[model samples]
Target chain A: MAEYVRLKPEPGRTVSDQLYQLGLEFPCGGCSACGGCRVRLVDGEIPITEGMREALREDELAAGWRLACQADAAVPVTLDIEQWSARILTDNTSVAFEPGEGFGAVMDLGTTTLVVELVDLATGDIRGVLAGLNPQGRHGSDVMSRIEFDLREPGVLCEHIRGALGAMLAEVAQGREVKEVLLCGNTAMHHLFCGESVEPLSHVPFSSPALGARTFAGSELGWKAEVVTFLPCVGGFVGSDLLAGLVACGMAESAEVMALMDLGTNGEIALGGRDGILCASTAAGPAFEGGRIRMGMRAGDGAIDRVEATEADAMRCHVLGGGEARGICGSGLVDAAAVGLALGMIAVSGRLNNAPLRLDGAVQLSQADIRELQLAKGAIAAGLEILRRQLPVEPDVVRTIHLAGAFGNYVRVESARRIGLLPSWKAPVAPVGNSAVRGARLLLLNPSRREAMIEAALRRTRHVDLGGDAEFQEAFIENMRFMPPGR
Target chain B: MADLETLRQAIIDGDAKTAGAVAREAVAAEMDALTVIQQYMVPAMDEVGRRYECEEFFVPELLLSARAMKAALEPIRPLLAASGAKPAGKVVIGTVKGDLHDIGKNLVASLLEGGGFEVIDLGADVSPQKFIDAVQSTGANIVALSALLTVTMPSIKMTIEALKAAGVRDKVKVMVGGAPLTQQFADQVGADAYSENATAAVTAARRLVAAG
Candidate 1:
């Protein structure tokens, strides 16, 4: 079954085209290969292609189901479209900033998703929130891939991202004047958006020296905002998003030992508080983002968000939207792996005891999937472990793990620790949802905080070269064992 | 004296300490270091490489076995040098510039060392000049290039061009391997071979040496 949305009737426009224009995330990126953009026709004659007939069942075809990627809108039709609710992390943190004249906008331009929040600065109220799959995704999924694409075709990335942000602004702004807009993203996204070449980011001694703040006018990016500001990037893969995360966590202000981990496709880990900061980006791959998994899908309706292993060794899945299981997302993947461990269904060496294990009779977990998860979790854990060694304070002395980003917000603490994705500690983990966006919002509300953040980012934070850390390699190998640390 | 079968089994089991102990015991029993490596250690690692190719052993298992062979080879290095014994081949390995990812490079180095190759590991983010310098200084038979990121994959060609400019391109066989590399890329970059993984890297290195 395909998800459908009822848009204001267009005489000749297709349902899929309308959704794509509205920024609905088609996982395959405007391709018909995955069939993720299927829509069910509620009323009117929508022509379905031969390819759709081959992929869809007879009952589905009879019930007016059509592949959105292939269907055309010939008449005014109300089709059931898959609604999107991008789980963006935006929890306010650090010192509050002063209101800047009129309404403001804050954006977190993640590699996969673009989340924008409209705020009324005068009233201190969030006017509206809008999110969509990054149209820049048509270029590539990860930073490295995006860099490669940028190197190949110079100007396309900036155009795509800027256009997508423009559409999003048009939707959420609702004719209201936004005084300023602030963006926080990884180094690649930041460079691509500002039309900076990524050639410097791709080779030896990899980093651009000129990663300071930049401001643009409304005419520049085709937006109504008076000014748009992008935060500074901290060398290597740890972009402005991480710097924003630091601002959100207030690493420079407090003497108390604290660590902030923004878990995502890249899994940037930073540790230390007052003495100094040791930060590194772990190439955790796309496992946690449901990349390269057998039945992996982005977190959305029908995606299995949670998994439980019954005492009888049965797999129970809790899907989003309370429907039949479609595919497992990141949180569910971790829970299933942890549950498999508890039941001895997966060996400590990351070999699944069961072959092609059926889950909820709708999904399957393969041995390769377990290994992918292990590799991903191991990289994150090893990165943290390496950061610990470089810090002046003992790792045990550090308290309050600030888990940033969406994956951090949703993943169970016990499961994360058990899987070694998060370092094993008794200290409370503060899941600061979307600290990047929150930090950007804070900066947007108060321009003064930007200087403070820049100062803090420059003086206090030190980028640890994990690529040179031998302890990291050892930690990575040792952590490859699926069991928790010291087991 | 450490029994030959027991030594081989120790290496196969990935027991580095036991493999080292057995190799030392064998040397103490009036056996030649080179002879011990040829009779037991190399054969064990070769079996592991074969198993990896056959899908009997995956990455973790293969890496473990490589570590065991490396440990066993450590005690014999001094003796091999004192006796003027030469390794199977000399391998110059490093992850290309702009790519800090060394896991693949390190794995290939470990596997090559286990296969009785003298590996000069340049580590990650090595420049083209550095790779050429290592090849010149070590007189390496093969230079294995690794790049995990697609953005950095072009370094393979740059390194190859450097090798040619130094008039040593033909002297050393170039083998490239990484997540995003392929045979077409290897051909385009003028590398002699392209390996899909560490185990295959060792095989390609051995084949390159043999062909030259």
Candidate 2:
């Protein structure tokens, strides 16, 4: 499904700006610092700048590959747009709801991806769905960078995301009478959406002043809806998405102690039950999403999405598209690390016995890649440990561990435990796919009790600031090893 | 004297309690503090650095060794000062402004201290003026800058420019390191050196001091 686009650059704007209008992603904030926005010139010519020269190899330059961030095409030019279409996890849980009139839209505004679902309120039937890369990625991929961008050019990122989501909601509504819209995102996304100052989130302790739930008249957002509501966040780093995840996982009603983990660049973890909950967010880095690894990528075609070890200690990689393995994704990375440990190619210290263990043709797991995983998983495991200590129950009393997000849904529980990414508690781990959307849908269906549930969840949860926590620091250092849980 | 071999092994094994005990015994015995550090402690750290470079040790191990070295150095630091012995070098370090992530920067600081540099850690979200004032007040010969986020990286360049504007750019060497940083980026931002990890950071700082 390859496509091409012909673009005429507007004055005072780079080609990346035009591409962003075309719903393209600039993973590096269009800074020309990364090669993620590279586009192949199919016809005509565009002047190359120093950024293009530095980012592209000689052969790539010879083949007309150019970084769109640095190019401002004066003449109309055709360019190949590869890696544009991406599959976002949109599976939702089926829950009974009290049917009402009109329609409602639910949105899960993630840092890297965005998913919106249109549903009939009366019958609780889904109408349409739209999922794609969040256009604000052109600003920055992570929340910290997005905060910095907003600090410089206030309201620019807000305009970008609001406009994008507004258009999407309108498209999903399709001129139907949409009564209300509900959204859930991280603290940064919530602040950006509300045009609130992100300065508080840019420092240690990361407590934001504007982290409360907000309701907006659809007229303000230029949507033909009655009202729009953003769910409230738990803490500075622990977002409303996790709160929605708690609702989706039925943690608020369960009397038994439980845990919910959404693993990503920002590893959000919660431990507790109806009595109380402790939530903390750890900077897990980009290793899980394949950002810092040498040859890591998203779970897509040609990407090694899974890895297994044979009895003879040989690795068997399963590519996403059943082709040659191009790179390893987060799930595959976890599995490979586990298999490497099983075969003695990796030590408990995460040291590779032989550096760059080849998993497939030209697809190898380097020593540094293993270190990245170690740091990422270590932060997550440490966060969980810290939260577990704060709970009233014993460590072994965690009845269930609900893994949220796409990474949690896809990563094997055994490999995660082997690498100490998940704890050794006997609680059966369950993958809860896209719980934020599911929770938002439930809230949309039960508008009468939505406010009460939000109040209850807020009252039952306490924010744990892991920054500068001595216990967390010690646990992080101790958990950085690759030893199996309970070791 | 204090069975310095045990002290050295304690540091290598990252046994902070044993390292601290041995160093305290050495201090009580009036063993020359400089001799203890140069002969036993620095070699242990060097071995740690070597292991880190060769991939035998990771960040946790490196951090543990640094902690053990810190514990061992505690009782000896006052003795060395009383003996009028000089430190290897004076370095000023901080995470650049608007960047709160400091784990990597802290590791680099610890390793630098273990490597025998007199480090003045200004902590995270450090403004350019703070760095300049610290250099002026402490007379630090080297400035280490770190930033973890891509958006906060330009502050490293701004700090360099501020150092130039303050007319102290030529007085001290500028070193930079972070997750989103590269050698090319360091050079682009006018940093004199870029180290990939904590051990490399110590080596770079030492090299910068030696070159001057």
Candidate 3:
């Protein structure tokens, strides 16, 4: 096994000389898209890699540099990728709604990101879209971490979250005439919003403040709107996000079977039929959002949105914004894993093939990247399998799979199917862009719709706690193999 | 007469049936219960604790052996009580408020009990005042707090402060453990000990008691 250590550059020490042991050229001499050349900062700084030069700013490079491609164990290096480099798509559209026109705003409070959209109640036409980092993320990135933070500060941490949401609402409204506000988020996020503690949501027999949709005056949250509605939660972990996704996909109205999935920080999936909706939330972590992986980014400019194994052992990438590839995002990650598996570039256990396959000119899929992707894909696949077992129908019985969220919007359905991330079904795959936002929009548009959402939230049943479910763990391990079952 | 040495070896080996029979034989022959517990049971559990710290044994094995030791001790409880034998210490342990996760707490309690500490497990969602009240009523030497949620961690600190306010903080050592807890955090919160797992909790408690 090849061992690489990332070193930080110091005054006396040169990075190029130290990285000589790794046997890579300074500029990595490989495809600039091959982000393998990036090195982690262990202690000192090294010169920036070509990928980092474009991805990072002058101040970031001046602080210290490390190649995203050629990391060496010779010294410690600090990581210096520009935060903006992680973003794939930039929305320049401004909020444009007239005040007192009965416009409403809907918000999806994700763990990593917060997205707010303004809609015209009469036509359901989107007026404006805005997104920002969830300020609560500074406390911790995952739900478990945030819960820990809440325990320490009591209501203090929750106040920070409310403030962030309030600011975003004010921004989205932008002096527009908003009559109602609708919000959709996970159960934990909802609990925090209502000033209810989330500690109960982390344990077994998980409980929430309320399992159904709730309504309060917008004034209650100090919003300018007349009424504010929160989409109902199904269980402690499976919240209104899944329900809203289901509703937006028109799953409730359809007699045909369907699965609604919101693949974000947590992979919340709801599979239902005319019988009823069964839901589960898997702790996929933030790997898809670029938390755990090396050189991973959100779907933004300079990110690798797609990857494929070329005729030779080389990898081809479709970069976002037509720039030098900086890092891979969630959709691109799925593509890389699926392609790697198909080409035998990665083993069922998620080990990269010993033979080096070029990503760009220089970077290659290391063992760590493979392991990270395995963990991510495994959690998702396991949740799907667990939900399948609890459902009354077979996998084939499901007629449609509606993928929601920005990550889902960018992923190619065939790549997802090829990776066994989703079950093999004959149903056509449809992308419902930000269904949480859409459902929130519905609540914003009509007071009756808000009430219906609350009622729908109350009716849904949450199935097995993914963390405590032994079968989920078994499925996770089985899915980690990455090969078709029985192979 | 095989001396205390031979009997202690039996207990350490976790041969509960043999240890119980030998203990009975020794008592019938006029041996003291306190001596059997101190010279035999405590030593055995101490070895178990050491083995656990070294990773030679995991949770299931430690739990099973503790069970065996408990089985042997059960029949001699009355005898030990009559002889006025005291436990090493008494502890009140539970998961903090708003957190209903208790597996970690239960495991630590079992290990503490096995280590000859009288453990009173209050279960999950225990309020800070409840911990203080338990310490006051039970006259426990230590309060073990567990919280799996970061959100609930403040409850651990609150319980400790509550104990301090009740004038019982000096009477008991505050020990906090959980997945999210670190030694630095425990120190910052003014806790005397922090352990990552149940076995470490036993070791930390023993060290705290010995130091006190």
Candidate closest to the true structure, highest lDDT:
2
Q: Provide the overall lDDT of each model, using Cα atoms, as 2-decimal numbers.
A: 0.78, 0.84, 0.69
Candidate 2 docking: what grade? acceptable
Order of all candidates by lDDT, from best down to worst? Answer: 2, 1, 3
- Model 2, A1-487: lDDT tens per residue? 1235666657877676676655454544455666867888988788988888888899998898988766677777878764332211223232346789988998888888888778788866556667778888988778888988898899988888888888888877789988899999999999999888888887655787788998999999887788889889899778888888877777776678889898866789999988999999898977888888899998766777678988777999877645678998898899999988988899988989888899989999888899889888989999899988877568679988888876775788999999999988889998776778777777888778888777777889998987667688778888999875458
Candidate 1 vs candidate 2: the TM-score winner is 1
Q: What is the lDDT of residue B22 in candidate 2?
A: 99
- Alpha carbon lDDT at A329, candidate 1: 83
| TM-score between model 3 and native | 0.60
Q: What's model 2's lDDT at A54?
A: 82
All DockQ scores: 0.44, 0.30, 0.11
Q: Arrange candidates, best DockQ first.
A: 1, 2, 3
TM-score pick, better of 2 and 3: 2
* Per-residue lDDT over A1-487 for candidate 1, one digit per residue giving the tens place of the 0 to 100 score: 1223445457666666676554444443344545656666887877777767777888988987777666676666657652232222234345665755678888888888888878777644455667788887777778878888888889998998999998888788889888888888887888899988788887756678657777899888898888888878887778888887877677766677788888788789888886788899988888877888898877766777677877777878777655677888888898888877877787777766657666765688877787788788888888888788777567578888998866765677877777777776666887777778766665666677668766876588888767657788878887877764454
DockQ, prediction 1: 0.44
Which runs of model 3 end up more than 4 angstroms from their true locations? Answer: A1-101, A212-214, A355-358, A361-364, A485-487, B1-212
Q: Weakest 10 consecutive residues, lDDT, candidate 3 chain A?
A: A84-93
Choose 1 or 2, whichever is better by lDDT: 2
Best by TM-score: 1
> Interface-residue RMSD per candidate?
2.3, 2.6, 7.9
Model 1: number of backbone collisions = 11
